[model samples]
Target: MSQSRSRVIKVHANDNVAIVVEQGGLAEGTTLDDGLVLTGAIPQGHKVALTDIRVDDPIVRYGEVIGTAVVAISRGEHVDETKVRLPQAPTLSDLPLAIRPVPEVEALEGYTFEGFRNPDGSVGTKNVLGITTSVQCVAGTVDYVVQRIKRELLPRYPNVDDVVGLNHTYGCGVAINAPAAIVPIRTLKNIALNPNFGDEVMVIGLGCEKLQPSTLLDDRPVKIYENTEAADPDANVLSLQDESFQGFGEMVEGIMAMAERHLERLNRRQRETCPASELVVGMQCGGSDAFSGVTANPAVGFATDLIVRAGGSVMFSEVTEVRDAIHLLTPRAVDESVGKALIREMEWYDRYLEQGQADRSANPSPGNKRGGLSNVVEKALGSVIKSGNSPIVDVIGPGERVRKRGLTFAATPASDFVCGTLQAAAGMNLQVFTTGRGTPYGLPMIPVIKVSTNSTLGQRWHDIIDLDAGRIASGEATIEDIGWELFHMILDVASGRKQVAADKLGIHNDLVLFNPAPIT
Candidate 1:
């Protein structure tokens, strides 16, 4: 293809660089539509300088400075990480707060989905029997029982979608009373209450662990149900280390009995039509690339706006991912308190990273660089696009259940598993994850809708990717088109009318707790 016809995506007219969009990138001597000649071969997704830049000159994209040029670069030269120096993160102080009026948009109405409504008024996308464990010692027992429940007992409860062991590495050999311990404790507690489990709480304990059953359920809002009455909190708990259990077989039998009771309750529950306001959707992006901002993330952002207009709750997280772009976000907060809360989370994470002797530059992994992101600054700009233009109504610390509707910033590590786990704990019934590179990440407690940023990854991982926003990059579809399509797919998936690629393949990642507390 001639260079003039070859595509390059320039995010902003002021940007001095644009990413090569051709599948194999462009060769040296190729000319762009604007008659700019490539100085060297540029890889797809990699940046090509649109203007000659002097050393220390700002490297702009997305209408913001992502970095500074470390060496003089001619126009059309490939702008890789080696040629750029990372910029300082935005200061947490003196930021804009609610300065711009939130644009008035037509309210989206009449959208509904069939979901299982819990007694606490939460909606569930899946009816699962979540077997919780107080300590890692009971994981094996829980896992074994989960298989038995699925094979021997689940068949009896046709309404139960799946049996999942809420397995994790916390609850033992740790500083349970530490200040930071609340993160993991509340995370596990809230995850058990995740609407998907149908409010049936059962616990398996090892009898000796730092995080005890009562402690785990302390002050919990929902009660474990036994028929019409509240069950003895202890009645639902099975300790494998209990003197009454003589052996592993007896232990397994004990768990199965408790599970059957919960399954019976869950099996009787049926899907009911719930208004869009009942939907709690989490927005996240991983395996990102330049196209992430250009396509999938932008499309997800549009869908996020739609969900907000429909009166639903949406959460967008990844603390480090938002740190650099926080200046842009703070002004969008609905009030001063919410904006400060955003700064607080950022400050906390900054100290956390400093204590560990690291900084934000550690992000944008090798794969990220290979995908054309020069540094965390550039990556953050793209990552925040998933939030769209919604005014941030609230901000919660890691593992805290969301308290407000519309868009809330749920602070979390950028790790895919940890973020998904925290979002689930925050009561997200469904997650919309966008990716430029591919990932098979999914959660057992909720439905995850995977969106591919580029058609290349979408086509290669066709079965694993639920939707392709790449059509936006190819001009085959607009962001609003994919946004509406995704919005509809979400309702379908929530109602069980459709299954996400990961769920269809039974692919799920383990729940990784965010435990900043020290080990014993």
Candidate 2:
């Protein structure tokens, strides 16, 4: 069959089974040499009987077990749900962390992107004016705050990107000490520290919350205002223009005047040469399928390697899909401590699920199964392909800043929507999202380039997706070729290209509001 499509050979080394990469016409009588003969039509990337397998015998692939046969499988026969099953692999924590393979290649020249260079040495994609919401008690206030400038003020001034409202779940119900509150607080801190920030931050809040805007932003310079004195109280926040409609107009004019100064300054900045390390790229996947691991994920993985080797930072989370490939990553651990930390995180989440809370088995949504994935472990093994083989540098939780470059980190709050949006807030200037299905998610300030696994979804969701890696699955392209395309695309999107989806639907979709989980 296709050499590039497959690596398995039927040389009779007793590897247990031969994996089918491309399934076209079998003609029923086709054979795999010797006594093996085709029994039925086969699916690409599925396994075939290379030798006689007993009903209870385990089927093997890549020198490791895949699943057991539900019935006696003869040589050259097809393997599907009635035959093979899924295997449970131990988390990397089960073994001592090992050293990563030495990199044998040269790094890229070092292609760099043009970005907004922050005073802190962090590069930003968009110059944004951040609006902070203190608590769930004032979530509506945050939205209303943006409408004031976006609808009323910015109609005349197009220079400023719309104000971003940060709303979340835990700021109201949970105590400050609970895990739920801790996570959101961490998320808030990350947003405040977002590299995309402009020279000024305007904070508005209701006075009665446990978390205060001024207290959270202790060190950062910002303008503070309260929402208690509005005419409508609930609908309209009390501003410097609160005395009367005429007086309020004057106050609004004053605030706008002050904001104009910051907008002028923001407009003056330009993209300059910056190290790839300064460009933090978040790798995300949603609506995945069989083509995902073989094509889009690995293609993104290759692009990920290119970026990482060039001194850039990449983070791939979504832990449920990383189960089967934990061993592959163990060899990439930079040190024993990093290895330990990676595994520790897995076990911690496992315990959290086992304690009668969220269950890991609940992963691999129905859409995943309908698309060919049977379970979470099967899904994770393929999922690990998104991160090419690179040294594990470090890990961070949700709302936490990714401090180390060339390191893979974990963020809590695994919802794809929340995770992808937070990546920008955590300082990622760009994000490469791979999907076997399709998603329309994007960020307020950050640009998201959607990479599809198959041509079907690519052609369907072309409006929102930026790059198409589906060529890999169609056998019309290779991972390296698609990887290069995606790499250059990151630069293009950064250089001021309006992606199809972002251009059509309007980008900058983010909301931090999470319902507060009660303290346990």
Candidate 3:
């Protein structure tokens, strides 16, 4: 018999199981708080049954039913996917609509950050010139032009933070007229209008692409134009196939000329004092483990509440991750309309998955299971906590701009890259991403603050992680401590006084549009 002391973490008072906190695992016959003994060896992060459960009984965590037992589970035995069956999805029609009252939050006063004030009353943490492209065909040429702008022109603009080509795989070889095509097209347009870009819209286009530059910016606002007849005097367009440019040299020159003008405008902007309310923060999780809900996520939730209290905006996305626990959200909607809107997005996604012949089970990847999440139900319960207890002020579809402040549920795919890009399109000026297995995910246009879910991952990837939320799991810090730290960190990043790990290492993932349309 082994004499090792092991401890378990119970998430809720009603939970019949608790997580094994011991490193590696606990062997059989291990003694517990009440003289109960482990019936078998349980792996770290895995659940240990605290009471006998009959077949078909509900498995509870976070005070909610995560799943139902598929087999009889006895005390001290391990509980995992093999022993549980996922429950059915919540029905949309009968979901409570805005039953919960809005949280009474005090206006946070005297909180300020140094930021670049935009002409549209927005604020930017960084002053970067974004070069938007109409289609994928011109990406190479646009990239080349960006390089030249950086080497030959960027140095002259000392105030400009950076110049990046907002290049993406869209605009060609697709059904541009299709109803769903509007999603990606609108996404590109909105990304160009992101606050960090400072309202300077410059478009590079392949003259033959289905998405013409004119169509992309048909009625959008702009800041740079050479003619009075232009719809947007502030926006400039460069068509590679224009008759004025006969050769590659002339094409490059034309792009360079337009770039110089924008760079000059961007360089003239300076950081000014802005309120915390000007901040729009995006919250997400990836590479999640069992400790995710127990540690990092709850910390993020606390921070989300702090942001809401400060009168700032916070967006929590990943539709599939929220689908199962959506019942927990409808009642929190600000009103009946907001609750219905939430249902519409969920129902739409259900049809989307059915069309693809998949379901929520397709979620909870192998890594999640290995990390002790049995199915989508468990993952979702953990995922939704990042939104905290804030009321759902609004719900927006993919790529749609956020209209209301407070907590907004921006519907998006769970894929890290795609969700990050969509959040940017939705006007996220900063991002907080928590991970367990770890991902070096970041966006060039915004600061991404990485939070680790466990101390082991935090220490191993110390250089890349901005905050070690693992302290909550290790008992070194309280959730409130990490939450306050994160809140302060957001202000520091917004003020440009600190740089996130992703930005320091120059690790940026490409923009991946959530195009649900077919390519014809």
Candidate 4:
């Protein structure tokens, strides 16, 4: 690459380093547009120092001090993880509260999609028959019965989308009475009631687990059915250990019979045109790279703001991802109380990580480093852009249902599966997942739209990636261009007009619970 043609991206005027934008990276000794020669081969997405740096000097990116120089560095040198030192996380005390002025955007109206309207006043993008399991002991049985139900019963019910077994690891041998147990417990209960399931709640239990099937529905208003007729909620549970079951055949038969009832009810559901306000969208990112912040995330953030303006609900989670960037969020809270709620979840996760002897630095997986992220600070700064600039109207603890509209910070683990599970439990009917390194992650109950950060990954994983924001980096499109494209894509997917790549490829990850409580 020559000095006149070599391209790099500098996010802020104060940023002393910029990412290499050349395909396959620039070779050693190649001169940048500014005439600074590369001291070594800089990989694509990797940072290049713009000036000489002494030991202990701060390395700035995104106009934030992501890390400090551990050793003396010269101008034009490749700035990789080994050259930088992780900085201390910001103290969560007396941070600004609801001080940022909200952008004066006109309300977006008349956007609508075809969705299943549940009796509980919730809208479902897909009508699925969800089979809830009480314990891990029944997971195999549920899986077996689910396959049978799909093969035998699903074909008869054309309106129902699919059957999903809600399998998890937290049921028996755990300290159910512990305070932390509420997370997984409520997560299971709420997932069973997700709008996508059409409020058809059914539980398959081992009969004697510490977490009883009935206990899962306590204090919750659930309408379970028997053969298309509303049955006693208490009678919705099918126990494998019951004396009525003669053998494995009988057990499977009994589960099929119960599932058929839910399928019958779900089959009766028809798509109705609902306003966009009924949409509950979850925003997440994984397998991220430097281009993630520059392209995909910012585009998703723009779409998030559009959703908020349209009176829809949007949630951005991953506690540790937001912890280091909490200062930027707290002031965006709609009120002081919402700001305090955000801090409360952060403090709770801090103690939880402390108990596990882990810290925020454990984030930004190896793939992230290979993609140009040095530490969690840089990752957090990039990660939070998915939330957009909307004032966060509410903050909810893990597993709790979303109670307010607009952008809500639903505190959850950064693990992709766990975050997806919790967001579903929080009533997310559709999800938008951004990736730079690329992932084929999907959920059985909801549609997941995968966005790629670069055109290279989009081309490599052509069928798996739904949209490519990399055009923004290549100057073929702008962030607003991709944002509007994603916004319309969301409506189309929500209306069942299109299928996401993950769904078409039949790729779905299992639900993993965040069990902070003790197991026996």
Candidate 5:
């Protein structure tokens, strides 16, 4: 790989294109480290052809075919999706399985963080009581009650962190009993059990909603069923539509009463020293540009290896984003079963998209195109790097809990909010989000560490981005250096010794559930 102040980075020996790293891009006739002169103006974070290319030629980057050129192109000309046609998606059948031996990762023991121990033997990075809502009908009332709790009750609970409304847009006016309903049902259940909530689960419901409060809490570790004949009569739940509730005041009072009980239980909890093995982190990227693969993501990949070596779990999702490179990942599976599982997910998503009369080509949003990503294939090459080189130990469906350690492929949509929600359901206590175009996205229940892919975005959104991964592209820091920095930063954030940018600014996006079922 060659990079210099001329600001062009050649990623691999076989790559026919390189990324322009200059802040404002280079003008025509600019010289690169290899003495290759630009034939025309090339925008920063965009690709430049390293050699002359003819029609139908492969445009290679990161040692893989990103796309095919549609027209003849001379050396040093700007190469983008306009000139490149999307290639065929990789076939899933007969993929290589468990062929790549797992590299020996030196065990990095003795790394610990301060966290709350739960009754289920899981560790929590944050201590708080989560009040879950069973239906959208109760969201407004629940939000009002949550604010009251923060003002009137939270002050008295010294040890507990702030309470969050486990609010989402599901539970009513849908195919509640359809086969696909299982996804949303399990997702909601798992989210209520997220490690950060400390198991003090409470529920707010409207009596007439299809998703009853009892349905959400029945037989769970922390049950709070509504007062109904089918539910535990003594089980405590706040139902706004209950016959006993005559007015808004009465409803809010009931919710506040329930909030105090859960808060009191949460207040007694304290942080204890725990090993890094207890950490379950979610890795994702949004608003991606070409530099994503070249800088931030590669650095995140290195950190992913560190986390895996430390015996922690890291989940990388976004099915559509990785579909094009599905064959590349199956070989890294820990065994044949895992490899088959990976293929099962890819095939399932393919069918799902087909049912909707669409395909992976719909990816690479306008922002991605403007940022220089040519197609889903190019994006997939960069997207998979965040998983590092770790063996794929397990693969789970959307909203399912991830049980094994190492890198797990949790299948979900590529939308930032939906993917984060599914990861949260999978029990991710901390999240790392990388971006080149920049987004102030975050979650209320977890700490989101944002990394910028280029220096321009880093300097422009200094307050929002927690890490400047762009340093790798600028030649100021190595990928390993940034990786170690992020690893330690996770420890500090998890231990409560420091706060990520999102937490400091109190920025959070709503949990948007993924429901493939039809609306009633």
Candidate 6:
């Protein structure tokens, strides 16, 4: 391992590239290993040329090509917007897929967590029953319904647990089914299929929308609540009888009576030994510092590998950041074609950025920049440590669940709330998030175990964060030790132990959807 310097770096060993850790401060012509030297003072986290190369030559990092050289390059020059290029991925069947010899480790015996196993064979990490709407127009009605249910029912029905609101934007304005609306579509899937939900949800709908409640049922059973009811002329009843139409008091009473019976039934189910294959771990990182890749990311990567060995899966998003870290992922590609498909996703999104659908600046937010990331490429290079070099199983749009196991998958659309929220909806029992700065966010039905990259953020915002990885950078702890600790914590939480931070602060992010979607 190389010692940390104040500025200037090349991340990969084989690469003909280097990064300007501290931008614009070089005394020109300073020498580095392999005859590399400063062409000029490059910006921090920006790359510098290592050797002369022609256009389309691969620029390697983490020992894989993130992109090809856009233009002819010379030795010891800055390699970024001016020099580096993005590449396209090939078809999935053509991609590489490898079945490595599974590691021989004793399975943790009787690793049962107290949770609900839905009829569809899904395990829920939390005991939450919620009313989720398809669009924003219906959000208020669901909110109203929750308020009514809580005020009237929770007071007496102890087993009913928590009544949550799962509503968001993105059912409309799509190309009829682009991966854009898939996130919410799957969210609806899990909520209905999840055993944690009561016998029947008081389904709410606007009656006349593209995404109707009935369509979501497909084969699932549900108790529909229509906001657009017809008139009852004989009895002189009002036309609309949705919970929204009823007085808040009456609505709550009705829901309470219905919930009392089901809550008890749900409680009778107990935890059992299910293989880790039953688990879907959602991986994320934010508020990062330089220590992210070295400490927290690699640490989670270990847990990721452990889960995969147990026959489970891991999910990573924010594709832009994944681009910079693509090197670590290439070998995981099942084959060369899979590797090509993975890179293609990166290239397509890069072109999308040029059209302004997304902004690269958003990659390293103002908060991230303050945390020591100067730009998106720098932040991206560090953000993807959690995937842990597993094979690229498949590519999914937002809100889609992981049907394939043994490695990571690329999910479209990015935003912590939406991404994390969708992961839970897609059926992750728990989510593991690492932050160098801090974030107080948890998906509904999944207990988030927040790990801070640094101790300062952990201590300062202890109320929201659950663990501290700061020691990784401080040289006080190793990833193996921290990863073991994290696995234990995950077990505890799965067994119904509340991550203190989430318990204390009451943080829950629900119904966050994105892309080509209506406000509702």
Best candidate (score: lDDT): 4
Off by over 4 Å in 1: 1-4, 220-234
The 10-residue segment of model 4 with minimum total lDDT is: 222-231
Residues 1-520 of candidate 5 have per-residue lDDT tens digits of 6785698988999999989999999999998877889988988889999999899999999999998999998898999789998999988877899899989879989999999889998888888778889998888888898899999999999998888998988989989999889899889989998999988778888878898877777576444444333454334577777776668887787777777877888898899999999999999999999999988899899999999999999999999999988878999999999999999999888988898999777999999988889899999999999999999999999999989988999999999999999999999989999999999999988988999999999999999999999999888999999999999999999999988888899898999999988889
Please report, in order, the local distance difference test score of every candidate based on alpha carbons: 0.89, 0.65, 0.88, 0.90, 0.89, 0.61
Worst 10 residues of 6 by lDDT: 231-240
Each candidate's number of clashing pairs is 0, 14, 4, 0, 0, 25
Error of 1 at 164 (Å): 0.5
lDDT by residue (1-520, candidate 1, tens digit) is 1123678888887899998888787899998878899999998889999999999999999999999999999998999999999998888888888776888999999999999999989999999999888898888778888888899999888899999999999988999999999999999999888999988888878878989876667775433323213334346666777676667887777777778888889999899999988899999999988889888888889999999999999999999999999999999999888998999999999999999999888999888888899999999999999998999999999999999889999999999999999999999999999988789999987999999988989999999999999888777899899999999999999999999999999999999999999999
- List where candidate 5 sits over 4 angstroms from the true fold: 221-236
Residues 175-279, candidate 3: write the lDDT tens digits. Answer: 999888878988888888789999888988887998988776868743333322233424588778877666888888777878787888898899999988888
Return the lDDT, model 1, position 181. 97
Better of 2 and 3 by TM-score: 3
- The C-alpha TM-scores of every prediction are 0.97, 0.83, 0.95, 0.97, 0.97, 0.74
Name the better of 4 and 6 by TM-score: 4
Candidate 4: tens digits of C-alpha lDDT, residues 1-520: 1112586888887788888877798899998767899999999889999999899999998889999999988999999999989998888888999988887999999999999999999999999999999999999999988998889889999999899999999889999999989999999999987899998888888978999888788876443333223334345678888776778887887788788767878899999999999999999999999888889999999999999999999999999998888888999989999999999999999999999999777998999999998889899999999999999999999999999889999999999999999999999999999998988899999999999998889889999999999888888899999999999999999999999988888899999998999998
Task: Indicate the residue-level lDDT of 1 in model 4.
Answer: 10
Q: Report the lDDT of model 4 for residue 216.
A: 80
**Candidate 3: pairs in clash:** 223-234, 224-233, 224-234, 225-233
Candidate 2 vs candidate 4: the TM-score winner is 4
